[model samples]
Target: METSSLDQVRAAEFASGGATAYLATASCGLLPRRAVEAVTALAERNATGSRGGAGSFDAVDRARAGFARIAGVDPGRVSTGGSVAVHVALVAASLPAGAEVLAPEGEFSSVVSPFAVRGDLRMRYVPLAGLAEAVRPETALVALSAAQSSDGRVADLDAVRAAAAAHGARTLLDASQSAGWLPLDAGAYDYTVTGAFKFLMCPRGTSFLTVTEEAQETLPVLYAGWLSAEDRWNSTYGPVRRLAADARRYDEPVAFLAYHGAEHALALVAEVGVDALYEHATGLAARFREGLGALGHPAVPGTSAIVAVPGLGAREPELADAGVLVSNRAGNLRAAFHVYNTEADVDRALDVLAR
Candidate 1:
């Protein structure tokens, strides 16, 4: 896309409606204008009882395709989930009983909670540095975030996958923090999960779980609802005899309304180009680091969108007071950059922090 047109797109759609500089896109991103219209249209249709379920289904299908494009995989591999945590848990539950789940210590709770709560499995919290050494014969899976939410450190997925594969274990990656904003070879892992609420620029409650052929072979269908059937609308229910022949067999029904907005959000990402978006975001982050460094508040270096400043917790309220939004992660202020972010946003944040 043309640079001028892209800037106009961001200004007209992303920055309208009193949008803030929202440096917290790593957490909860702003919903784009197209997405807002999608949700509104769907709600209106439903309220009038003219809701074409076909439109909702198309939205879901498009959403699946959108995420698949980002993950560099076919749509057949992607499944819908209400949220990342739910799908992560479902995937965890499918593992062999009494198996071991190796995860990084201080990882996001959603990534670890599902495995930790599994009574039949043992969860080992190891450091990111210890992941390779921790893989053992009993290890059933290695769970990790593609980008560390704490400091935005991009995981060495190739190394992690190789280590897990050496022990005949599957690898599950949470791409929630990195997917829409970063260039990821997501198909490298056995399974991957991401949500649309963050950098995808949609509302909450839309998650995509992509399962590789290896994962589908070993992972059991833990849950199968109407949406998981080959003929979902076939209400001729007898004993639930037929299941989908693909990964959809494990999926459950989600809020179709949310997906209408998610589809539009994903379209926006495609228009902007994922690789270009990552470059744009990281460029802004580099500028942020330089500016903050000059102000004696250098942010820690990392490859992903989030820029973490160590020990800046006390400045949270001050930032909010200045209309500059950021988040506190691991006792530091985290300012995230995305395709919608501008240099002015970074300058505003820096000016506020310098106070």
Candidate 2:
């Protein structure tokens, strides 16, 4: 597509105000105008209880199907959830008692907290650089985010999978940071989880999990809600029933209205094409890095959309006063880029840092 055509399409999709340096994608993405419209339509339906059951069900199914396509998995393998933390709990609870779960140090707190609280499970943290050497036979599950939440470092999924396989470990990938900006093949891992609010441009409180066929039989369902069963509407009986299949087995009750917004966001992404979006986003990051370098504020090595820079140990508030919105962790300023950001935004950020 021509550059002008692509820019026009992106502008149309971006509904936010004047593009004053939006570097907070790691926290939450700027919702597109169409997504806002979809959300509003859903609200209107819910207001009058006019959201037909069949229509809602179909919308939810299509959202799951859209997530499946984006993750390169079968629609039957995708399950809906409210957030990444919920999915992590599902994964942690599914493991056998006393199983060791291996993950990278500095992983998102959501992934770490659940495993940490499990008395029967052992939690192991390996440095991101040393993951290949850390997998062991006793590790029942090896979970890591495809992109580091702290520094936006992209992991080599193929290598991680190979290492996990060598140790007979099943792998779960948190693709929340990479999904809409990178090509994710669900076949590469046993389970993959992602939140729709970031690069997917959906509203908050929306997420999905996909499980490989090999894991469908082995992984346990921790929180089996009414929606998870084979016949969710069947009110017959004594005890609650387990879901019949993989995706359905891990399902939970969620607002189909929220899912409709997510579906619209995914459809917009599909129209733009993931490969094209990836290239655009990466290019923008590269430009931001270059601008930061010129301002003597270069990004940390291995940075991508999420860039981390050195900051005064406790003086990060200074940057905030300068009109540059960024988050700090352990004396590092982390800035994230997305499709909504532009070269001018990078320049503006550089100007703020320079001041």
Candidate 3:
């Protein structure tokens, strides 16, 4: 599909939604109407037992390819799953018993917890700004969110990646908060995981992992099953002695419904392009921040798609009552703008907060 301008995108794909100002996309994005229909149509096919109805696998393949385009990786490097923690666990489990894992302080739990939970792994936390400088020869892995979930602070991925490479340490990037509107190359890291339910704007129950070939060979195949076989259809009833040679070896059994919606959602993202998405979303966030300043509720400083105002978390319910739905996290009122949002939406939210 040819990419559309942000104007065409908002009007065509994101025009209908319930909230007066859906400023909570950082919490969970608004699904495009086509995505909703794709999911619903799959369910209808299942219920009616339509001819050749077992086409759910097609959706999975399409979503995988769509995400590959978004992440700038080959489909073979991509693996499918349902949770960030679960995928991260694979990387964590592969670390040597006493390997050191370096991560940013206040990084999202899924990105850090997997390594932490491994009692033998030494987990060190540093501020996001100092992460690159903190990487050492002893650090076996450097893990982080591409964008901080708490305040929308984007990490310097280039610096971190270079530091990790210099130290011969692998890098794992969690793009759950960044992938949709933040253009990034997943292949740049040793491993990258993203949950589609949030910024990727799909339904719950689908996540993706991309691995470098070296990382794939280093990780174990402890979770292999019928679905992990290179010939899944033929190996469904057997011991599945041979797993897929690529990242698909890490695949969990497919989630039919989630990927059905994801196929459409990821395609829409590709159609809109993340660079355009970044401009459109962050523009609204900047507008919202400017308005918040005028209202004397200066937000956490950043140019990302999410704007969080400290000390205004208590006002979340007040804004919601006034039809401006947003989120409160870590004592900050977080508002995220996406393709659907407009200056009008930003103004409406500011007007509500003005009182």
Candidate 4:
């Protein structure tokens, strides 16, 4: 698709981020106009004491459905949460005592730290490229990010899944960096978690998880609350005779304003289609990566939405001051391309970095 074609989306949905170029979707995505309005509407409703926040459940339900569609899973398989770490903790607690957990080295703390804190579980780390080959018979679970945050190297989902299956180990995929643009098959993994703020372009408090039926049977509903019941109204002030029949059993009380925004944010993702965003963003990333190499900067090589050049982290402040927004991650200058960005945005950042 031509670069001009995406300008309408940038103008309509993302007209407000105060930057000459926004290449920081890896850090946080700018909210769309519709999402801003949705959040404002919810705040006004709350101010008027309408339903005392009961209306949030409707938004929460729609967000759940939107995420289910984005991740290619049934709505019943998805559960709402405020963060990835909490969901990781739940999965971590479900493991057998002293079970060996395998993960990629430098895996995000939200994924690896939960298992580490357990201390009972044996945690093993391998290079991201070798994750599949390292899976052993004794491995109980393989937890990792779909795309690495520090550097945007995407994990090989198929190879890892096949390896885990052969070893009878479960899989937990953190889709935080890949969900909005990268095509995701949440159902293929035993469990998948996403902190949607970064790429899904929602409020910070929104996150989601998908649990397979076999995996669901294994995870204890340790975080159950009123929403955990099949009928929440009946669940109040009781022994909770019937819990949610599906993954909803793991639901937490949502951040009301956040989900209200998420409802619109995820709708925008559905409207654009992940494949289109993938083509657009990766095209911009490739352009930027090529530009960086020509400038004698060595970037982490990949066709990922994020492109990071090492030894250039110190340039981030100067780049931002020049109005080309980006991030510095683990000593690499990281620029994330997203649907809202354009060729001009990429070139503007490149131009600033060249100086």
Candidate 5:
């Protein structure tokens, strides 16, 4: 695909929904043609009953390769799951018992629920601004999202990593909102979790989890399945079963179709280039905010693709009626841009908001 420029991306032959302005990449992204094709091919294989054969289901391997590329880690370090929620639970299960986890209030429930449900652990909710100060001796891990799901505000990852390091605490990041839209250093954190359905423009039921070397050695495997076994195909029914030494051993059994779709989605992201995509989306968001400002519906300042406009919460239906699609968050309207978004879409949205 010729995705070198925004014009090329806007005009590319892809399967973007006919929304005047989608602006909801934060919720769910439109699937690209490559991803669609992958799913279609997988369906064909399944129809012939050929998908269940050995080596026929290479989707998991392909999807892991995609994640490894984005995370700057070896494919062996990558794990897959049906959803980010499942990955979160796996990571939580690996933590040392009785360890304290520091997290922010109002975090995405999936990110909080896994730790909260751990009876052996304690969770301390702290503001993002006070995260560093809240890290204490008992803090074994610190968790937060790379981007705020509500307002699209980005977290200072470097600072957060430093703070966690100072306290000898491992950093666990939820990168679901930022995975395809932003550049991520997965190896920098002790563990990183993300899904492909959002910015990656893949189907649901595909999530990636990356763990560092330290995390691999210290964390215990609470959940085990044949797919994650050291010898996955081994018919060993004994009480003593061996596990894979890499992070892949922690993966859950996910649908092969999800992996097939994710492989193509990640390929599309690679073709577009993450840095270029981020710059283009950010530029579009800035222009979007500017247009709204001229229309007396100013967007909040943000570096992410999401632009939040106050007082538009009640007017969501009104905007939708005029062929605009956005999400309501924290009493604000969140219009999120993506690689598929164009200036024309922004203008269409602006025209509706102006009314």
Candidate 6:
């Protein structure tokens, strides 16, 4: 589709959601119509005993390919996981001993806990302002969230990657909140992790990790399961010594049927084009910030799509009762916007705050 035409379609889709304010893309996103249809079709297929054998294989392959395309990586470099946190832990555990990991001070617990618990690993918490100065030759890894979950502050990835390169450190990004709303340059990092449920508009429990070619050779396998083996399901397979070159080396064997819903959701996002979806979301977020300013609830300076506005010291429950749904983070009301939200929704949310 032409760029303008695609933008118009996105705008119309956002407008069709009606007047209910949905400023929560950071927490969850509204599933698109196509995703809903795909989920239903998958559910029906499962009900009719079409889930196994050749059909299931095709379904799984399509899902992997869809994820790889969105991530801007080769299909062989993508792996499915139950959650982004799980994959982050897996990556952390696989790093070499005595590795020093540099991360933000107030990052999500999932990103912090894995590296913190290792006896041989040293964790350094870099202040947001001093991240560039924290990189050192001893640092083996630099892990960070693409966007700060608390206030939607985006990291300067170019600088971060450059610093890590100078220190001979591998970079890993937790892109759970930024993937669907921003253009991801896969060539810039060693590994990128994301969850499908949040911005990808998929069901919960669907997550993925994209690894670079260098990571494939250097990183050790932390959670190698049957599926991660070279010939996991081959009937004639004897003991296999080599792991698959693909990112399938990170996948676990247990399958969650609900993941089909998440896979279908990701496919829809890919069809819509992530760049277009990101533009729509950022535009809506700008409108929402403007509306919030008019209501005397200005967003924190330098905030991105996941904006945080002061609640005038009101409790979070009070804001919810006022007909606005948002998250409370560090004494601020967090608001998010996605492709399915309209300007009218922002106005309505502001109206609630005005009361």
**What lDDT score is found at residue 38 in candidate 6?**
57
lDDT of 2 by residue, 1-355 (tens): 4557568876788754553566778878878778788878878766777846323767778888888888888899899888788888877877878899888988988877777888889988988878867888898888899898777888877788898999899998998988888888987888888988988888887899888887877667776766777777772364466565668768767766678788888888777778877877788788877877887776777646777777622434665665556667667777777777777676767777777
Instruction: For model 3, name the residue pairs that clash.
Output: none
Q: lDDT of model 1 at residue 27?
A: 80
TM-score of each: 0.94, 0.92, 0.96, 0.97, 0.92, 0.88
The lDDT for every candidate, in the order shown, is 0.82, 0.78, 0.88, 0.91, 0.81, 0.74
Candidate 6 versus the native: TM-score?
0.88
Candidate 3 lDDT by residue in tens digits, 1-355:
2235666777777755655778888888888889999888888888899974555777898899999999999999999999999999999989989999999998898888878887999999999999999999999999999888888888899999999999999999999988899997999999999998887899898899999998887888778998899888888885997788888889888788889999999999988778888888888889989999998998888798988898888889998998888998888888888888888889988888887
How many angstroms is residue 220 displaced in model 3 relative to the true structure, after the best TM-score fit? 1.5
**Winner by lDDT:** 4
Where's the lowest-lDDT run of ten residues in candidate 6? 51-60
| Model 4: ten consecutive residues of lowest lDDT | 1-10
Candidate 1 lowest-lDDT run of ten: 12-21
Off by over 4 Å in 1: 17-19, 51-55
Candidate 5: 10-residue stretch with minimal lDDT: 51-60
lDDT per residue (tens digit) for residues 262-297 in model 6: 667777677778877777777777887887788767
Tell me the spans in candidate 4 whose CA falls farther than 4 Å from its real position: 1-5, 16-19, 51-54
Answer with 2 or 3, whichever has the higher TM-score: 3
Candidate 6 residue pairs that clash: none
Indicate the TM-score of model 3.
Answer: 0.96
Clashing residue pairs in all predictions, respectively, total: 0, 0, 0, 0, 0, 0
Give the per-residue lDDT digits (tens) of candidate 1, residues 62-86.
8888878878998889888778888
Q: After TM-score superposition, what is the CA distance of residue 9 in candidate 4 from its true location, in Å? A: 1.8
